[model samples]
Target: MRSKESDQTKEGSPSIVDSRFTQTLRNVQGLLKGRSFPGKVLITRLSGQLDESSIPPPAYLRSFSDSDVGPIELDNTFEDGFQSRSNSNASSSSSKMRTLSNTEAMSDQVQKSTMGARAIDSARLMKFTKELSTTTVILERLRELAWSGVPHQIRPKVWRLLLGYAPPNSDRRDGILRRKRQEYLDCAAQYYDISDMDRTDEEISMLHQIAVDCPRTVPDVAFFQQAEVQKSLERILYTWAIRHPASGYVQGINDLATPFLVVFLSEYLEGNVDGWSVADLPPSTISDVEADCYWCLSKLLDGMQDHYTFAQPGIQRLVFKLKELVRRIDERVSTHMEEQGLEFLQFAFRWFNCLLIREIPFHLVTRLWDTYIAEGDALPDFLVYISASFLLTWSDELLKLDFPEMVMFLQHLPTQSWSHIELEMVLSRAYMWHTMFNNSPSHLVN
Candidate 1:
């Protein structure tokens, strides 16, 4: 009897499957007849199971709703690919169909959204080009553009101009860069080319510190690890330290020079900069890149010299200000932190020390600096607000964690995967907070 029942089950299984397939085909044909999609759709299955990973979440679809493109209609042929089933299987098949529909919609939206972003980027590039094309650049107009963001292609030139390393006047720019580049080479020879045996203990220590930090700087980036890139960084940092006795090769300053190096090197290389090797460039070109990076780094550090001097008083002061600022903005998070014995300096010191370079991904660093450089001398003050904004961005999550957990989380902020969008949001909040606090300083005071 058991053998006869087993035989019956096997004999009935194919009919049941065929019936479901026929029903699904009818449903798909109905859908296709009702819709006007003009393409053949092919769907194949290796097994009966569906790959859930292939389907995007509903939230992902909503994220791109603001794209300039019109709503994408579901392709009838694509919908026709899934066969229906009976009972619970029927429900599962319907969900699979919906997921496939959503997947295609999301793909369309993402493509359109990317196209829109590229269009905007191209427009921005054109604007920068037009502004830079003039014999004498309008500094004010250039600052306004640079504040929003600089195009990667023109960022090398824009950063120099913004930092006052390169002149705003086009004709003078070439002559000035030539002289400055040569001047940098001379400075390197005078200060950096010396043997360790001839150097003072302090000079030797600083050189050693820079050497130690060079490979450690942006370690995740393959570009920085290259022998040539590390040497360029060492020369740039050592020379800047020698020139600026007030803040001689501070640990975090190594991180600061990275943005300049990447930007300057960008002029000589293209595509994924992280993969580029400095060895590919001619020595003269490399020398020029190093010179530009040195000058720009110098210009950047000049504003916040005290931040790295002696005990880094500027950083201490900024951290204190950040604590106060957060207290005013989100007193709950502030009070909770104090109650938990958490100090802003514990985490924020690195943020200020590295200009949040250590906190964010390397790619977004240059974009963040666009606004920073645009702020000019105000960067130091503006930076405190930026730090406060950055800290408060994780307030909700931070509130949930205990002191030790908070410290660990902040020390290793989950920003390794952050993109330009997240970075822009931080900058936007910082700008808003800066504007609010500057106008009403009393709110920030005890």
Candidate 2:
């Protein structure tokens, strides 16, 4: 089989005029190829025109109720206490995102520009450490605190505790880390040795894909741009893939590994790890981070392993659910999308697969993960609701566009300026939506 990366190399760089068209086509191709449907004709229908009479009644129309779910009440003391921006106009609406409180006394635009690296709150940091030390692990309390946002400095240790990677017993912590880190290094010594001549064809192919994807994983991050950093990523991804042959080496898994890598790497750094150069770090420090990341990422993926399995059942179910959820939540947007012949998979596949890693900034992504791990095994189910709410966050803007424009808008949202505060708002709204509608059956009537 021809490799995906090799196909790109042979085509060379696409011209500016056809780039968007070429890119969108490639995206569609990848979606269809990655998934397994009955036939080629059935799959090709994804991009074809939708005839009104042929469209099935939306899944939610027959199932869910139109009754009002009560308004969401947010806590006032939550980090960067945010007020949801409201706009009556359509075109300017997506701009109406979560912003700092009025008492902050600055415009949202101004706040965005001036916001730098988030500072760790000493009280919260102390509180988290104390809670972690307690004999009885109060998970509900931890989830509440984590939902607000983990302090940046303590996030690495906090994540380990939250994910069950660290023991509840403090006495056993050092021994566990020592054993796990060495286990990873030993695996690397055996399987990841590039010098080995006996590497199988599948192993070679997996490594090639990892190498091609490593630099592209988090292109904007200065930390990920270094050759050494990319090699660390390569080892983690390749090692994980080789071990888990069932879901081996999916494209989006590469994106999923970065948050763990960065967060774990921060544990060893003196100051903000964002500005610290990877080349300046010792090889052992890098190896320790790689080991920790491998284990934590394994924990994360374990819940949603079906997502990257044969045909990605988890994503398929999610896109279907997202369509149904949107139909019930926002009829206009759903109707508009149906009229445009849009399948939820086109925009939503990456959303489910990567846990919105590609959509949000890295710092914010870690904060999001803090809540995800805290939420326990239900992350996959809850993410469908989050993805639905995230899509509708731009409903006003999406309602204004045509087919191609809507696709482009949904793919690259106006999230360039989104910070931890904005992320908190999105997650908060999603939690409300999930609570209200998740259990309401499609057969129920208002």
Candidate 3:
């Protein structure tokens, strides 16, 4: 029973209950355009804006096909319109990213100038170096945005900016991500604004059915590389929740599918499902967005089905159980915080709501994601790790907190509180500490 966070802890026998549910994220991440997989909050933010800017299309755009956008006419009418967004908008992003990238590269070169040419050896090193520079610049931009608490609606544009992906309103020449969003918006606007005079109720019903079946007819994986993938994935999820009625699309499901669609839209779009709902789409060529949505939803709910138990399932039970686990794991920290008079629900809501997305920094979110994927069916491990990390790292600060201040800090806690180094230390040691204490002969609750 040594703590998973223990620095000196050793491995124990692995938990059973088939852990692949969480591992699929790795698979989806591999298929996406980005270098890493982000957890829920970040991914949801990215998914909405992965293609919002007007920068040039990524080099990989060709890998995804026009069909991936669902139902495109031969002319692809929306393409030209997306590319021509005003220069005022894109100039800011394009110039900003370039300045940051250049400055970062120069800094690295200056630092390594002492090392000589030997440092920039392989093509890979050059790439890594370049990306690192990009990373620093991007991180700064993200920090500024996060600090401002940008509205979720406008975040998609910021995401494309960070990825160096073109924005949604840019010319088609810029990049598929941008091109795709514009297209999605256009299609959305058009589909949502059908001409009642042109179509009867039967026709509308037929269109919906057609939309549901389009993915079946159009087997394209390239779409995952573009924004269409996200839209399609979302549609699939919504459709599934509606179709199932039993599992009406939950909040976290969107969070789950957003990044997956960001990476594997092509794979998802190619698949089909029963009870698809394409009744509202355009004629003959509409996308089966609904079928694929359900399929993707099913895929997501594949592993974590237990957590979604309805009626009188495990919801409250899990919460209380987690409280017990936290009590056992770190009563001193918990008691200290409670003594400060902070209600557990105030700041703790975000932890459970998004599964700790806001509790950890982006880097650690990725790291936690990596570990999460590596260890499926390890929900308790994740929850415990977050708890253990928060307590252990912030114990110093907590001991000094008077009540209101502690609640204030927790309620509006910044992502920076969960720094990568601290997170790594926690992940490596928390489990160790937990197991060690559990196995202790006569350990008393602090």
Candidate 4:
């Protein structure tokens, strides 16, 4: 003879399962509310599930009220400070109960945060898709959207369009790409396919330098180290140098090609592009990728040819502008550097030459380029402000270090673990600084 409790337990099990199932449906419905056809299907399915009279209604779901959950907050406090305060209050059973309450609240916060992020990402992707779906893309609108950031899945197409390597008119896009790709092939055959005996002494020297630097480019990334990838780099660089005799080849120019290569190759591959094997692709496919990289790289360098030309006078001018801008924005940091006898060019030359590609991690390069390409012809002027913003980010640390230490620290900046959060902060600061200084002609004159 079992007790009444046993009967109750057996009877209540189905209700417990049904309640959980209903809660799951409610959550899914909340997620799908503003979505498309799938949302209608989910609503229909949920209505059928809710028809049972014995099943209770779901508990009223609380709204996710935190507005700051999705973005990277620039002014967040230290977690340790909050933890210390909480530790001080934990003294008795009641305090233990409060601790448990806090844990539940923290878990809820995390759930809401995750949901908020997903919603934001979904909305952004939809916006991009809508803009790109048109027969003729309005480039100004595309540039505005891309300036904020681009989604990874669609970044390749977006970069191509923004750089003018791909045509805006959908009707002309395919034909243009095919023509450009074939033109690149002809260029490769004429310039790169020739033997050393047929090449001039200067051409041979430049080819050797490019070959040497290709291996050294982004050495930390194994994707670049692949033999096929290196060969592609060599071909693109050499072909570009041969065509444009004015700038020819420069050491930092190899670093510039990397972002385009990674972006274009990502169109065909997925995952960490660094680990992808170019050899896995067909020869024709590799040639196409190389062609895209070459043209896009040329389009990019077209604006600031002096940056890689003899003596790189354009870079030197930008460096001077950065010094003046930094002086105006953060006088103390500038004074401290001057007191320590630190020159901006000693470190900022690399920043301007490579567009800070060497200064930041390889993965963040594409995200950074999205903004650079968006800047269009103004990139040279805007780059000075970006450099100043980047320098001022390390203002406090630079103030404490002497000249030698400053040189070492600036050269090997500790940015290996940096995520999009840090990079976005830098960009936001740069834009703010640009807005303040851009129209003021005298800001950089002194």
Q: Which candidate is the best by TM-score?
A: 4
**For residues 1-446, could you state the per-residue lDDT of candidate 1 as single tens digits?**
35857745753576333343333333333333333221112222222322444224533211110111223344544344333212235567667766667567667766876787677667667878899999998877887777767777788888899889988888899899999999999999999898888799999988988899899999888888898889999999999988988777789989999898888888878888767977768999999999999999999888888998999999999898889888876766888999999988888898899999988888778778888898899899989878876887687898898999998999998997766555655665566556556767876676
Per-prediction tally of clashes: 0, 3, 50, 0
Q: Per-residue lDDT for 392 in model 4?
A: 76
Task: Please provide, for model 2 over 78-126, each residue's C-alpha lDDT reduced to its tens digit, 9 standing for 90 to 100.
Answer: 3243434333233244433334343353454344433321122444566
Q: What tens-digit string does per-residue lDDT give for candidate 4 at 226-311?
A: 99899999999999999999989999999999998998888888788756988779999999999999999999999999988889
User: Per-prediction RMSD in angstroms?
Assistant: 16.9, 16.5, 20.1, 18.0
Please give the distance, in angstroms, between residue 204's alpha carbon in candidate 3 and its true position after superposition.
16
> Where does candidate 4 clash, by residue pair?
none
Candidate 4 TM-score, C-alpha based:
0.80
lDDT of 2: 0.70
Instruction: Report the error of model 3 at residue 150, Å.
Output: 30
lDDT of each: 0.75, 0.70, 0.41, 0.77
Native-vs-model 3 lDDT? Answer: 0.41
